[model samples]
Target: MLEIVPIRSDSRARARVKVRPPAFLGEPEPDTSVGQEISKAGVGIILCAGALIGLGGFLFFIGGLLTSGGITGFVKGWLTAFTGI
Candidate 1:
């Protein structure tokens, strides 16, 4: 013979908060050097990219200045090219 147990219905909802991992989950290994190396590499990559972008922008500006002269030259060139005068 089997007996059935009845659960009581509480008016309030239970608080569901996950404070800790289940016992079966393995603990992570602590390696400070790995995180530090990753951060250093990330910073290096960011700095290199920023430098490249700045260099490219400088080259573009110089090229634009050489191509026409400056704002006035660019406008004159544009007017001459379109108006043929």
Candidate 2:
């Protein structure tokens, strides 16, 4: 197989190396509008998960109030208000 090597101006065995500029000479470009959309979606997911967790906790609390021994009038009232039972 033929090997590709850099051409040298000198007749010497050493090869001349060409200098190149830095790969990144300046600051990177800013993110586009898609980045904003991703940010909004992330926030939306967090909010949705939080709301679901809060609702689940509320339901669990209500269940506890209804199921615990010696149910009080206040607990019954709350259960009736929430479940219409």
Query: Of the candidates shown, which would achieve the greatest lDDT relative to the real structure?
Result: 1
**How far off is residue 12 in model 2, in Å?**
65
Q: Compute the lDDT for candidate 2.
A: 0.75
Clashes of each: 0, 0
| Per-model lDDT | 0.78, 0.75
Per-residue lDDT of 1-85 in model 2, one digit per residue for the tens?
A: 9999988777567678987554464333343367776787899999999999999999987777667644586577778889997
Local accuracy of candidate 1 as per-residue lDDT tens digits, 2-61: 999787686677798966644443333343467776787899999999999999999987
C-alpha TM-scores of all predictions: 0.46, 0.44
Model 1, poorest ten-residue lDDT window? 23-32
Residue 54 of model 1 has an lDDT of 100
Q: How far is candidate 1 from the true structure (C-alpha RMSD, Å)?
A: 11.8
